[model samples]
Target chain A: MKKLTKDDLQAIKQEELKKETANWIKVGLSTCGIAAGAQDIYDFLVEEVKKRNLGVSIQRCGCAGMCYAEPLIEVKVEGMPKVFYGKVNKETAMKIVEKHIGGKILVNDHIYDIRSSQ
Target chain B: MQQKRILIKDTDLKKDRTRDFYTAFLTEIQDKKLEEKVQLVRVSDIGIYGKGLTVRVLPENFLYCDVETGDISRIVSESVVEGRPIEALLHKPDDKQLRLVLRNCGLVDPESIDDYIKHDGYQAIATILEKMTPEKVIEEMKISELRGRGGAGFPTWLKWKLTRAVEADQKYVICNGDEGDPGAYMDRSVLEGDPHSVIEGMMIAAYVIGATKGFFYIRAEYPLAIERVNRAVTQAHEYGLLGENILGSSFKLDIEIRLGAGAFVCGEETALISSVEGKRGYPRPRPPYPSVKGLWGKPTVINNVETLANIPLIMLKGGKWFSSIGTEKSKGSKVFALTGKVKNSGLIEVPMGTTLKEIVFEIGGGGIAGKKVKAVQTGGPSGGVIPEDFINAPVGYESLQKLGSIMGSGGMIVMNEDDCMVDIAKFYLRFCVDESCGKCAPCRIGGTQLLHLLEKISEGKGEIEDLDRLRRISRAMQKAALCGLGQTAPNPVLSTLRYFEDEYKAHIVEKKCPAGRCAGLFHFSIIEEKCKRCGLCFRNCPVQAVSGNRDQGYLIFEEKCINCGRCFEVCKFEAVSRG
Candidate 1:
């Protein structure tokens, strides 16, 4: 990458904004999340997404301050409300994919917080 | 397509009526035959406490607290069916948390610079370099009323101005990341979660203070934070945001990272400066503060990680915007590492005036293991304990100080009824004693004396006179200690003594640890009726203290027992009794 000038910073920001992102899943990969078995869940999500050829993008983020609910996963589909699921393992991660992504219904008993950034 | 959602959680401490309320609400919705229209969800936490059966209607955002079975029909009709709220059950929640510094904490991908820039990352420094002058930058900081988040609550602009006033050959800026508080890792989380922000904040600080060199004094314990900060600096340098002539400007600055050798004293500014200069981490007396004479006899400005993290946001949104968030004296949001007995033990960023109750109950999701909260310990060892009675008091720099606690680096540990106040004070005192550099007599001697007094009290050998001696030693340490570490080491003991003198009196007069935490004070015995003869205690006892077979029943030999409480831990039945 070239050394950025002021002009390049804006162009990069604009380019980043213009990128198409329709569906995504963000896992809290901070120390707290990682300590709560988030790495396995992240790997599981990545593997399952690749195997099933899903259109969802998996990203890593930091702690959302709810340490009680670790391995926190934020799932966003096009039509459904963006939901935050917590204390997730491989089984729950798979359930999140099946019911939340495919079936367009939020998972029960695993939802810690629910809000839409959009 | 019409979709409505309702989230229900029982906030009552007595019993969980969430399932009962959910069933009744579901029955009512089915009776109305509007099950398709409304989707009722049972949430684990609704961010409200002690409100008895809470119901939140989605999209319309109507909240009904203390909801009864009768209110379910009205909630379904008025809120869910009609999309309007009933005045009887309407609840207007006073939201205490306002995220400013932690705006990008959980939202963005921490490793990616592009993800950061998309959320206005380098924009603050980019604009500052292009438009603002050094004086204007300082003026903006002054206007923002942003104080230091490193516990002292020193005004940021004043520190910068003091460094700028001195005509030094070379000036340096340091981001203090040596967070050594036992239950505090707010700095670590911020550095890991948002490294670029700290880097940007440092760049902005450097620009204002005319410092060409900066260093990150982070502890070695935080390997992830160190790695992320190293990556962030490299990324900034690559983007022309760090090196000479940053962003096509004449101003030049460079940043470096220095690892601390796990010294709690180094968290203090002068001690941190010495450690950065490759000397033994010891704090010298202040007259020439670090801002005036620091980092190899050159002027230096050392800001805490959280303080530096607030800079980009302040610059981007303007100073006035930042000033509007906090209390009269304290400005902007504070990020606390809320841990220890708190249900939601994590990083919480709330405005200055947020009450302790709001942070502990609402944001923290109340206490863990169904225990009643006893007190909240703020500022680690250097902070005092705020008893459960005073939890409704607003949290600010001055307010916490008034209650015998300083807002020391935002380490808020929620303590429960099981936490003995004397034992709590002893823990912090021990930490300080180990970290003390033995530079001054008051801190070196007084800290040890205070620790001894606490140990004596916790062991049930305390005299009433020991309490007065503790106060005397604490006052001396507070007045005569060389650095911030020594000065504030006595806070825990002093504050606990002030609020929980009765607990200490119990230990002294009755030879009892009311919380049963002091093992020397409380003896463990097996309740014969409750004992299941499982032999678990006999098998697991470290000292072979527990004896006898399953049919004969087990016994804990108090003579050989070291009071380590291992048999108590291994008992399958509720057989182990302690008083």
Candidate 2:
């Protein structure tokens, strides 16, 4: 890789943040998340997404501070609002992939928070 | 699709019907003939506590507290439809938490170098390496007025200046990441969340102090943080930021990771340095401080993880800007791990001078299960307990210190009425005793004696004279101990005794644990009047302590009862009495 000039660094940053990608899922991958079996959930989601040929992009991030409720998975579909699901296991991860991602319906009881575009 | 939002909360604290709150909300929303347009959603947590009914409207984000059936129309019509706030019932809650150290935590990918650069990460290092002189950097730090976050409130700039003044061919900068305070993980979170920012901070420190070698002293408990930091350092080296000349500058620095063996005492500077040198982790007397003689007899500058995290921001935003955020002496925000009986127990960063009330109620969403807050324990095991009466005191270094607590690594544990002061002190002292290196006399011997006395008092076997004995020993340990481990270990016991001596008196004179925490002081009995012959308690009890049939009703055999409180916990009806 070439040495990044000031403008090059600025452009790279802008480009990374520029894309307004819809339909994405982020799983907490911190120590808390790992303890709560987030790695299993992450692997299950990745495998299911590939098998089903889903368009949603799966990503990994750090802890969102709510550690008591870990294996925390956040799902956001194109037109649907973003929701954080707490205490998520493999079953819930599959349910999220099937319902929240494939279908537009939201599963109850596991939802922690819901946020709109505003 | 029409942008309708409703927040539901169980306002009645006298009884718990939090589960039934959703049904009531659904019924109310359906009565308005607007159930289709408005989606009735159940939130796992609503950031408000103790209020009866809390309803919020989306997009506008207008909140109404203590909402009733009569006011539901006004909420649905004016706020939801018209997008206007209700003036009378509006809750103007002040959020105390200011997020300084944890500004980017959970928001950024820690392992990615590009992601770190995206948030103006390396700009500080570039600015420092290109233009600023070592003296100027140290001057800026002095102007910033940042006290050490690793307790004691030592001026960070003065530490750097002293190290810079020491003449040595080779110097070192070490980031102290060996955080071992109970209920405190603020450092771990920052390192795991934003690894590059701290690396950049350390790099800046290296440049300013003219040190070519730096060490990241992290505890073994945080494996993930170590992994991410190791990856970040390797990437920095690959990009010519760590090894040799970086960004066409002649200054060169190399960083290494040193794992601590998970000893609480190793957090002390002397002990930490000793541990890094592959020697015993016991602290020696500090006449020639680490700034003068450190790491292989060379001058070294050691800074806490949270302290180093602030350096990048200080450089990016001018030091003056960084200095202006806090109070007169203490500057910038503090990241507190708000745990133990807090509603939303998570990481909160509030600016200095923000009150404990605001942190406990506004940002932390009040006490756990809407129970009244009894006391807040700050600064971890080495810190003291601040009672509910002084919740209004602003959280600056001097203010907390005045309340008999030092801001030690920001572990803020909120306690409810269920917590006993004596029990709390005993817990902390027990923790110190367990982690004590046993190298020195005051810590090794005094700590064990204190724990034994506390245990005896809790078990209904103590005299009033023990209180005077506790004070005497605590003083001796504080003044004569070899390191901070012994010096501050008695803080919790001393502070609790000073503030809540009446509780200790009750333990000693009345032979009662007021909070029902001590097993010896409490008794388990099956209330014959309340028992409905369900026999659930008898079946659930680990020990078959409950006797008698439905005809005679249930009676607890006190001798057989181990008092695990399993009978109290499993009984659906309030049939078991514990005193």
Model 1 C-alpha lDDT per residue in residues B1-579, reported as the tens digit of each score: 267878887877444466677789889989998878777777776678778888888778788889888888778877887888888888898767777767777888888888888888888888988898888999999999999999888999999999999998899999999999888988888888888999989988888888999999999998888888898888888877888888788878899999999999999888898899899998988979878899999989999999998999988889999988888998888989899998778788899998999899988878998899999999998999999999998889999999988788999999998899999999999999999999999989999999998899888889999989999999898898999888899999989989999999999999999988998998889999999898888888888988889888988788888788778777778799887
lDDT of each: 0.87, 0.83
Question: For all the models shown, what interface RMSD does each have?
Answer: 1.9, 2.5
DockQ of each: 0.66, 0.45
lDDT of 2: 0.83
Error of 2 at A100 (Å): 5.4
Q: Cα deviation of B29 in candidate 2 (Å)?
A: 7.1
- How far does residue B437 in candidate 2 sit from its true spot (Å)? 2.1
Pairs that collide, model 2: B11-B52, B98-B349, B98-B350, B99-B349
Q: How many clashes would you count in candidate 1?
A: 0
Task: Tell how far residue B445 is off in model 1, in angstroms.
Answer: 2.4
Worst 10 residues of 2 chain B by lDDT: B10-19
lDDT of 2 by residue, B263-332 (tens): 9989999898999999989888896898999888899989999999998888888789888998998899
